[model samples]
Target: MFDVPLMNRYGLLAAAMSVLLCATAGPARGEEISLQKAVEIAVQNNVELNAFRKEEGLREAAKTKAGLLPNPTLELSLESGALTGNSGENAFSVGVSQEFLLAGKREKRLALAQKELEVYRWQLADRERLLRLDAKARFYQVLLAVRKLKLAEGGIELNRHLYQVAKERLAAGDIPELELNLVQVELARSEGAKTAALEAVLSSRAELSLLLGGSEVDPALPTGPLEAGGAVKEAQGDLFRLALERRPDLKALRAEAEKGSAELSLAQAEGVPNLTAGLGLKRDTTTVEVAGLEGKDTSYTVGITLSMPIPLFDKNQSGVREASVRRDTAGSRLAVAVKRVEREVATAYASLSNAEQLLSLYLRNVMPQLEENLKLTSEAYQLGEVPVLTVFEEQKKYLEVNQGYLEALNQRQQALFKLEAAAATELTGGVH
Candidate 1:
């Protein structure tokens, strides 16, 4: 019989071991990394970004080849035949030939290749920007995990003190054994929560280390305290306009559209005929023996050859249609990209506004009231005016609210990051 619980237990154990291995494999040395350093490391080691850089180099090489003139061809021939009755003749010829692209064909090809190179170059830039955003997101995740672990540890310490006070009261018969049992159970729960939090921190650290392309990581990340006091002013419309102009992905799409236009031009140019011209020098030597008379003659000939393709069967008409279709597709894709960026920016702005409001409410109203309630409940329990259960409930409420507030703060910070990423702007409100 299949056993689901057994499988789940094994899966959990495997996951725990994986986390432990990642945590213990390599230790970070030197000072902790700032956000800038983290972003730099991700850019240098990210596999996708490096692949794009290599692709850009290949496109550049292709562009160079496209701009070069075609190589000339060499022709050689030898012949032996009868020049007269019972006489033999030999001829040898050599010529050099070159084909010239007609009607600015080479120029059009070069232009198309240049546009394609620009597209790849901008694509690489776009990949770098996305990689930086990924790194920043992972960095903040680790920071959040670390913060949560600290909160859990603080809760454990507070619970330990309360357990000790409960033990003293139970020894003096001021509190019943049931109250002491409740404190003990709460301490145990706190310990479990702390353990879970620590596991989360380690997991986040390992993820970040992998993103940095190395195993060594400092789990103790520094996060600046939240600053919510600044006035909440709406971002300018011009800022979003600048982001539309400067965002690398949008630029890459624009370049792609231009390359498609060039492709269309090249396809149209294919209808023009190319010319192949050659200059040739030939030598003919003949010996004639007519019943006792012999003569030798040699002659040189210069000739010009012109070759052009006939537009009878195929004049690349299909290529023109294909190119036109591709251009239209590129145009459509570009429009869709523009719309997506606009929606992304709007969504991020809305999230930031909501997060700011939530953080403010938690900081100014919710947390302070929870703290006061906890204090009052503690005093009442000491004076026997309230049951010990009331005090315990108040403390639990206080801890829950504290955790909620921390979550709200982290959410706001993440929202700010989203806004920056969407707008392609720095935190300083300038275009990145």
Candidate 2:
């Protein structure tokens, strides 16, 4: 008994050690992720996407089941009664029956099921596209927040230096105390803005983490700057064509139309009569005295029976009509889907072109000039050729321009994401 207890204790210790080892090894396996990795994680772990995947699995199973034949049925019967005031008679019967669907009923059902599966397939694809777009948007927002925070920090630094200069000038009787106090006030405000910008960066990072399936991410994550390389030259027609051909929503609508056609076929098939055939055997016995033979027994041979429903009152004409109406409705909906996708593509293309132009203007003309002017103003202040206030105002202008440039870049990235989403293409060369 002591040996058994000792073995149990050692086994427990070994199991505990194994668990500890696994725990220690887990984090090492955690991936050093990029934007594509984050998007993949979101696609895999998002609850809505997972639910849709499960629904697709169920639809596939339904499709498989729909292709199978109907189940055969078994039947039995027994009877007993007194006859001829002498004795009792008994009868027993057993039968097996199966209904054969007419007019391609099984094939129609299978086709409908297959069309439904396609709908769900396209639904999953659409979800993937939307989720990736969302991830890209959030990723760019985080980058923008970081850029703004950096700009705010630079402003704070410049303001602090100006505050110190103002204090020295006041002490040496070169500037009024009120001027120094005003600089100190501006420095404090700059510090506050910097703190707010830092908080915004952290918040944006947290939001990105949630989008990446609740995985923690570094607030200082690096992102590639937006570049305008693939802007559509002839936007309207090409975008419309791409949207009509590749958009998942349009695909889903087309699938619905196919399903509706299948349903109509199935309803028409239902109007045809289905045949049920059965084979049975029966035995009968009777006891009588006055008849030609007393206690007679009889056996009936097995025979086949066929059945079909009469088409007097209802031949499923109404069902076929309803299915026809539904098919028409589905066709109309698909048309609407095509038109909607075309409009969306046109809108996205227009916005993308506008954002690209604005971004180019900021990059080429405004930001470079602002940087040079800020430098000149700083130098002029150092040489006492301009007042300190001029230097401060020019510094503010530089920071503002830089912030605006970052915003324009972010807007361009977002527009690109939307355009790709509309076109159902990968803009980043990989999914994001």
Candidate 3:
């Protein structure tokens, strides 16, 4: 017979708490990372995010190009009359001209380019926001997997202990062979469960590693509590307000609309034709035949010329219309984005509330009693007051309840992440 102290020593709740507290060290020997470290790594090294960041440089170069002036054109010409037997008669001309932008087109083009750069900057900010959210979610996934693996390990040990107790009872003739066989079956099932849990741990860690831009061959280990996280206490209205003020994508759309307006201004300015003004010096050499000899006479002239398109054929009407339409479309999209963000905040707020309530129920009521239930059942079976099947049922129930509790924790943590993402701000302890 087993001692009651032995029955109480490894109670389910105590084992679960110990596992939750101490099992955060990852299975592998890789570097252990907290949630903050994971997100920082992802932002710094994620290939796609870094690629998106390069677009800012492109936009900056475009802005620089937009602000530059058009280059001047140099013209030269020379003529000889040698083919007509007048080799001494020749002319040479040199000219320089510059095409000047009309109607402030250069300024407008530069404005549009500047607006485009602003839009891209806001978009990059939004991309970073989304990357942070994704990294947090993946970290939570790894935490959930690790917790499950630990729980599964504890289940294996509990089953092994029960199996040994059953063997002792069987040898002393207190229990039948079938009881020992049943305990053996439970032990095998626990081992199989552990295998599955370990697989889940590996898979989740691999995903996190990829997100962090780490090598899959040596994935980083996530170290955090699955149950520990923050929740928002703000009302849905307040959260939606914060989202409107903070969402970078919304700001990007606003900047895009402004850029469209600048585009329209530039298109209108483009309808005005540029003027090319030139200054030239011409030299002419001729032989005079009336002076009884071949005396040479030279003449020099200076002239100015101006030219410009008439704008009678095309006036950039299509370009103007296109820009107007683009502006309107951006405005419409911004309106739609506002509505979408509101919806997202509402949905996330509701989800977080539900998950919090469910987790609270588990923590306050269900999880508190499981240890006593398992301990009492095990002691009763050891004293021969209950059958072996009763102990098995209690143990099975303990595993199921803990699994449910772990799921609750994961759901709650995910709900918090979604809410923070929707609002585009951190909501720790109900404060932004």
- lDDT string, candidate 2, 162-213, tens digits: 6655555565667678888788888888789889988987888788787776
Enumerate residue pairs that collide in model 3: none
Evaluated against the true structure, the overall lDDT of model 2 is 0.73
Candidate 1 lDDT = 0.72
CA lDDT, every prediction?
0.72, 0.73, 0.82
Give me the runs in candidate 3 sitting further than 4 Å from their true place. 1-31, 215-220, 429-432
For all predictions, the C-alpha RMSD in Å is: 10.0, 15.6, 3.1
39 Cα displacement, candidate 3 (Å): 0.8
Best by lDDT: 3
* Greater-TM-score candidate between 2 and 3: 3
Instruction: Let me know the TM-score candidate 1 reaches against the reference structure.
Output: 0.87
lDDT of 3 at 200: 96
Arranged by lDDT with the best first, the candidates are 3, 2, 1
CA lDDT of 82 in candidate 1? Answer: 59
Model 2 error, position 250 (Å): 1.2
